[model samples]
Every structure is written in structure tokens, then in C-alpha cells.
Target: MTQGVMSGAGCACQPVEAVTAETFARSWSGVSALAWRVPLLAWALLVVAWSGASFWGPPEMWFLYMTHWGLLFILLEMVFGVIVAAVKTPEKNPDEESGLPWYVRVYWLLYNITIPVAFLITIFYWCILKPASKNTHVNYAPNPVLDVMLHGVNSVAMLVELALSRHPSRLLDVVQPWVFASVYMFFTLIYFFAGGLDPWGNAFIYPVVDWSKPEQTAVVITLTGLFLTLMHLATIGLASLRDRLIRRCRRDSAGVYNEGFTA
Candidate 1:
């Protein structure tokens, strides 16, 4: 059993024969419709409240930060999830796991983008930037509660969504976050040359992202790219573990049901 667990005997790391609308709509461990709806709605509300409270600075500047980018994507993802969960999915037999649809594929891609980017923003901020800010005596925390919500709670919400959702994590989808990051990097380059300022009125939007020092910034980007790769890999691992646990629970339940039937 231990070996089977370690080897991922029943994990859904890849797509099962075929993915369907239910793949994106249902919860892995839940039978009720409320499973997906309740959490998605809660996240949507929290995102709106936190974003509104912290959105006091120059309205335009909010789009310039990668933090806001993650928040915005998460909000959109949750709203999409809530809508999708409301729709009635077509029922099929256990053996009929075929006919994956285009929109379901798009929803899965959105999930791929949403989960990792949310974690990337949270880890990048708290692990790397927060300590550096302290050394420079830069108080990025104007509102401590808002800071935690943006950087800390963002990842927690994503983690919960990860465990609850039945979506499969394709390894190839790891490039999704990298593409998203590249777009923002390109924007920052244009913003730098155009002399865009951070909310603090500095010529560079982020101290760590100053293009004036191209070599240093390039190294930071390189390291960050590697970290992003690891983050996605870690997400895949966690998803596998969730699937493995679910498989075990289902197996045990089946065993008891069979024994009772025989009795």
C-alpha cells in the first residue's frame, strides 16, 4: 500500500481517458452542488472587499504591479468558477469518460494560469521582497491587514481551490504562468523606458525591478523564472497528493460497502 501510494497508483496526474464539462464543474470529493459554489462565492466576495479597501492610491498605478495582476486574475477565475458551477453538466457512465469539449479546455487553461500565478505572487512577496524592504527601511505595509490579504491570503485561497477542484494538472500547462510573467515583464520594460513611476513617485516601479541596472535586474528575472517553474511543479505535486488521498478514501469506502452487501 505504501509503495502504491508513493508510485501514485490512483492519482489523476493526467487526464482520464477524456475530460468533460464535469471535469471543470464538479468537486473531487463532494457530491452536492454547494461544494464548488460556496467557496467560489466566498473568494469572490473577499477579493472585492480587499481590493476596494487597498485601492486608495493612484488608480492607474494598480495595474502596474504584478500583485494586482494576480488578484485580478483570481477574481476573474472565481467568478468564472461560480458561473460554471451553476450550469447543469451532462451525466455519463463511469466507463464513458470521453468527448472533452473546447470550452472545458479553456476553463482548464484558466485554472492553470490562476493557481500558480497566485502562489507565485504570494511567495515572491513574502519570501523575497518583504525582508529586503525591511533592510532598506522601506515600509511597504501601509495597512497590515491589506498587506496580508494581498500577499498571504491570496495563496491560501488558491490552495483551498486546488484541493477542492477536480481539474487535472497537466505538466505541459506549466508554461502558462511563464507566458503570463513574460507579458508583464515586457510591459515593465516599456514602462521603464517611458519613465513610469511607482506609487512612491520613484522613477522605477519596483526597487528590485529597476531597469537602470539591467544586469542585476536580469539576474533577478532569471532566478524568478526558475522559482516560478518550481512553484508550478510543487502545485502538480500537491494535486497528485490530493488525488491519491481521494482515491484511498473511495477504495476504503467501496471495501466496506462490498463487505456489508455480502453479509
Candidate 2:
């Protein structure tokens, strides 16, 4: 009787092993098909488009122009390559869906590509454009649209990753607020001191401080710096609170899975 029970258990385990192996083989074969190839081709087209536009287009349209075009390209690639392809054949197992979503994969690819492009644009602006325009006395204002778009996307991405990843330790939760505050304070002091000296222009592109009088400029710079510092702190605090709430919601939903499985 003991030998018969052991044989029955062995038979049950063998089918599971066979099923897993078969599923893996099928998934691998599907992955080996056009999934990656289509994305690669689209990415190549994006590189060509961006390079051509930068090389041929006017200097004024360089940064934002290229960035916008690159984003559009990646968006299209995601829709066609990842979403369309994945939907054509859905995986039956929920465990397979636990991996990254199509949107996240596309976002990461775009982010990776954007980093190099941003570096190149910075080099071009500083090395070539700035020096050429320096003697011409052209006061170029920073593009507020580009700044907001880039930073906003980055912040959203960070929030998404934090939500999806497993729960953070208490240390990370505590350190996050302090790190943000300290960096904000450090930059606030630097901006205050630098603005007081030149008051007419900022360290980067535009000047917010009035430089007509030394005493007045110092006062304006100090006040502006304090305002910006407070703004940064508020932004950080709100974002941290929102993220914590989102994480708690995800944790609560995850708790249902185990109970349902047992029931």
C-alpha cells in the first residue's frame, strides 16, 4: 500500500514537470520570432530620423525637436511591436503576466535612448552653440516646455517603478524625504549666493533677479531662493505621500491572492 501511494504521487509530479517544460519551449519559440526583430527595426528608424533631423535642421530646433520626434517614434513602436504582437497570442498562465507590462518595457527603452540623446544635445549646445553665440550677445531663455516635460516624465516613471516593485524597507521610506530636503537646501543656498553676485542672469540660461542695484539684487535673490526651496520641499512631501498610499493599496490587493488560492 505504501509503494502504491508513492507511485501515485510520482505520477502527479511528472505531468507538472512535463507541462512546465512544454510551456517554456513554446514561449521561447514565440519569443524567438519577430517580437524583438520588429522593435529593433523601429528603433533603427528612430535613430536615423533623429540623426537626420539634427544634422539637417536649424540649430534652434535641435533639443525639443529631436526629443519630441524620438518620443513619437517610441510610442508607435510600442503600440505596434509590443502591444499588437502580444495580443495576437495571449499567454494562458497568470504567472507569465507577472513580468513587465508592455508599456513599462517601452518606457524603459525610450528612457535609455533619451539619455544618450540628451548628453549629445548638451555637448552640442555647450561646446558649439554657446561659444558661437557668446560674442553675439544673444540672451537665450531656457525652454520651459522641455524642462517640464522631461522632469515630469522622469518623476512619473519613478513613481510607477516604486509602486510595482516590492515593498520598500523602513530605511528607504525614512531616507527618501531627508535626501530630497537636503538636496533642495543645498541647491537653494547655491542659487541664492550665485544670484546675489550677478542678479541679472542665472547660472544656467535666464536671470530672475534684478541687477540694477546691488542691495536690491541681494534682497530679491534671497527671497526668491527661499520661495523655491519651500516649493521643492512641498513637492517632495506630496509625492512621497502619494507614493506611500499607492504602495499600501497594492499590498492590500496582493493579500487577496493567497486567500483565494487556498479557498
- The most accurate candidate by TM-score is 1
Candidate 2 lDDT, tens digit per residue, 19-65?
22112112222342233435444554554454445432344333323
Candidate 1: deviation at residue 189, Å?
0.8
Q: Give the C-alpha lDDT of model 2.
A: 0.35
Clashing pairs in 1: none
Against the reference, the lDDT scores of all candidates come to 0.69, 0.35
Estimated TM-score per prediction?
Answer: 0.81, 0.26
lDDT of 1 by residue, 1-263 (tens): 11111122243232232344665676765454347546765766786566656775687777888888888778777766765666665554322323444445555666788788888888889888887677663556788888888888888888888887765575666789899899999999999999887776777766787899999899989998888888888788878677668767775321101000110
Q: Give the C-alpha miss distance for residue 223 in model 1, angstroms.
A: 0.9
**Candidate 2: which stretches are off by over 4 Å?**
1-205, 210-212, 250-263
Model 2: clashing residue pairs? none
